[model samples]
Target: MMPIDRERSDADMNSLKRTKLAYSILSIVLIVIGIYLIIRPQTAMLTVCRVLGVVLMFYGIIRLLGYFSHDMYQLAFQFDLAMGIFSLVAGCIFLFRTEWIAELIPAFIGVIVLIDAVFKIQTSLDAKRFGISKWWLILILAVIAGALGAMLLVIPLKVVEFVMVLIGINLVIDGVLNFWVVHDTVRMIDSL
Candidate 1:
């Protein structure tokens, strides 16, 4: 390969690594938040909103970065650009209008998760085409997450605590699914 090409490849690899790391961090954060919600469903609404706002903003930035990174398969980050913008806007609303947003947070987050789950279903199919052995697992998890997200959307606001628990469960599952997909499918050139 030409020297310039090699340099570009190296830069791309570095960016990919950073993107993966950022994604991993975001996944971990989701798991932690999920656990928190599960354990303390009765926590103050404003505090929960603030925490979710920060997390959503962070996830948005990470998703944007991941979209720009050079993933070998290109499946993992395909929907990131749009999702990032959506997340950023949602985060802003949550932060600036916590009181107004508290009631709607579940539905908003449900939409985000549902969208991600749908994209992940596509990613799993692409992974199958690429001959990844664990693609079915991704498909199953994505389906489950999608169901959970749909439930969140339809559940009445009167059942806030139950909704919180469901959201926590969904977040945990989604986080694990994302982390596994990124680690399993996102390959550095040297590993190829």
Candidate 2:
């Protein structure tokens, strides 16, 4: 009984609805993680920083060995040699002075996150200029982001662990939401 144009419009609405739901779920997860990081940053900071250092050291060592060895893989060897040595040095630094280095981790991450949020808010505002309905959402998000940034800059050592935990939570949430989209889309297509 429905007109062809009405059917098309309905289909478009369904698609948009699905997309928005998925995005909202992912955003909620990320916000939860951000909250966690705000609460418990020190432990997260140390663990992440140490792991990163070790990985770097491993790559550096491989690079250095490859250059001196007979394998001569050329590009890979050179890359490995450089990375291996640098990683080893970095790993040592992290291993020995985790306490000192960990303090910087939270602040560094906060700055990066704050910058990213600002960019996102700018984009959201731009969208609003095109007559989008959620201009207030961007303002709220920006305020939260700015507050978190200030916290990080003021308290690095105390914040790293919390930040790490929060970031981990966000990633897991994002991954789950993305996986859910694949599920919902499959279900929708099956129904059709």
Candidate 3:
């Protein structure tokens, strides 16, 4: 029994080490890709656009099929059907207009960011009402995000370089944060 337990412990240790190694590699790779994307914004944006187009088309088809397969209320299906059509059209437009998609990518991202910031601001407001400490921090970050998004939307071309730089900074931070994850995992494994 003692021998068997020892063997099991050794195996677990080995597995944990391998997992740690894998995570470190993944984090490094992501950091590299992020840096590359920052350096070559246009190229990265184009690749992203193509992928988005394919995803949109795939989801659109699924949506259409699901709506047609079940006889739902015409009123509900009408909205769903319209959304599906819109998705399909947008996807096709992306697939065919790669350059155009690239040009519009910043604005699209900006819109998403702006929406996210608004949601964050709302959450912070609720937090403030609840007497949560540092709600203002969230509000501040939200405001910054909204400002950056607005810049992207209003002057995409001008903001393109800034966006790329921000992406690079985020990636670097992500990579650094991943190191913390690895450290925690290692500590947990030791505890186990």
Candidate 4:
């Protein structure tokens, strides 16, 4: 390879490593937050919203970075650009307009999760075609997460505790599924 190409390749590899690390951190955070919500459904809504806002923003930035990372397969982050932008916008609204968006938070989050699940479904299919063995797991998790997200959309805001628990379940599933997809599908190998 030319010197310039080698340098670029090195940079891409570094970016990919960082993106993978970010995804790992994000996944753990999601799982922890999900457990917290599950354990304390009665926690103040404002607190939950603030925390979620920060998490969503972080997730958005990570997804954007992942989208640009030079993974060999390019399957994991194909839909991340759009998802990242949507997450950033939602995070901003949740953070800046907390009071106004409080009651609608569940539905908004539901939309995000649903969209992610849909994209993961496509990713899983692509992975299957690419001969990945764990594709079925991704598809199953995405389906379950999608169902939970849809439930969040239709849930009456009157049932605050139930909504919180449901959201927690969805988050846990999404986190695990995303972690798996990123770990399994994103490859940095220069030679196929």
Candidate 5:
């Protein structure tokens, strides 16, 4: 019984180690790809759009067929079905005419960032209601984010370079954060 318990414990430890290793690898890969997308926005966007479109189209078709065949089709779920079709159409447009669609990528990202920054800034202001000076950093970062977003709109040419640099900075930050988390988790697991 003692030997059996020891073997089980060893196996459990090995499994936990494997899981942590996998998570670390996955996090690193995601961060790398994110950085790559920012560096080569046009190409990455084109590829992602095309792939997404194809997947959405297929999903739509599958859902549409199920909707007709199944008696339990809900109206709310139909919205998802419609969205899939829309995604497919949008993807097809980008896949076929990437040059025109490519322009939309930067603009869309810019608008998203602008909205995000505005929200962050607002949250920071709201925090000021509590009289917190730390919120000032959030406000400053928000302004920087909005400025970077505006740069994309005001000067499209430089946006690519800015995006690349921003991505590099983000990746470094994310990598460091993830590394710390991974290290802590490993330590905790080992302590167990």
Candidate 6:
């Protein structure tokens, strides 16, 4: 008799592949923007900071609305509330303190890169868990991302242009890997 203890179905496989495809596409866009940043480091830093500030403020407004509008998971809701407030404050700092924030943009980018590297690794693992083919490729990409992120953090930002170059290179490579992931996901979907 065949064992009948598996959770995967065709639908699950399709869903997984689709999700990875979407994620890969998004990563590709971000990577392209990153390349632009590399090309114009100083200006890009200001733009990135401004964008972040706007995002934070928008997120804060959304979250703050949630408190009044709907019921949320208790723990998650609490966390959201806290984060919403924090983001609002942080956003204000970024917007109002442009000069100070400008000075810290490199550090901010480093921290963001480092954090994203950790998530990319986890995302790679998640793809593997879903039985995506050539999952190891994502793992390799994750490793590369981690190394690049670490370099951003560990290296001093004495020369802002140097930091930009590193970031640019990382983004270009990241974008390339994203496309690879997309291609692999598409192949997997076709096979399925």
Model 6 per-residue lDDT tens digits across residues 1-192: 223323344444555445444445545665776777777777556766676577557646544543333221121122346545865886777788877887776566455455545655665666676676677787787688768877877667687778877877776666666466545533332354
Q: Mind giving the per-residue lDDT tens digits that candidate 1 earns over 77-115? A: 988999899989888888999999988978887898899
Backbone collision count in every prediction? Answer: 0, 27, 0, 0, 0, 0
Candidate 5, 90-180: lDDT as tens digits = 5566568766766665454355456545755665665565454455666676677677666556555456555545543343333333333
Candidate 3, residue 159: the lDDT equals 65
TM-score for all models, in order of appearance: 0.96, 0.41, 0.44, 0.97, 0.41, 0.56
lDDT of each: 0.90, 0.48, 0.56, 0.90, 0.49, 0.59
Give the Å shift of residue 165 in candidate 1. 1.0
lDDT of 5: 0.49
lDDT tens digits by residue: candidate 2, 92-141:
77767887867665565455446545644554555455454555555455
Q: Which stretches of candidate 5 lie over 4 Å from their true place?
A: 1-34, 37-43, 48-100, 157-192
Residue 20 of model 5, lDDT score: 48
Best candidate (score: lDDT) = 4
Candidate 1: worst-modelled 10 consecutive residues by lDDT:
40-49
- Backbone clash pairs for candidate 6 read none
Deviating ranges (above 4 Å) for candidate 6 = 1-25, 42-44, 51-97, 174-192
Q: Which candidate, 1 or 3, would have the higher lDDT against the true structure?
A: 1
When superposed on Cα atoms, how far off is each prediction in RMSD? Answer: 1.2, 15.3, 13.0, 1.2, 12.5, 9.3
- Model 1: residue 192 alpha-carbon error in angstroms: 1.7
Which of 3 and 5 is the better model by lDDT? 3
Of candidates 2 and 1, the better by TM-score: 1
lDDT, candidate 3, at 144: 72
TM-score sort, best first: 4, 1, 6, 3, 5, 2
Worst 10 residues of 4 by lDDT: 183-192
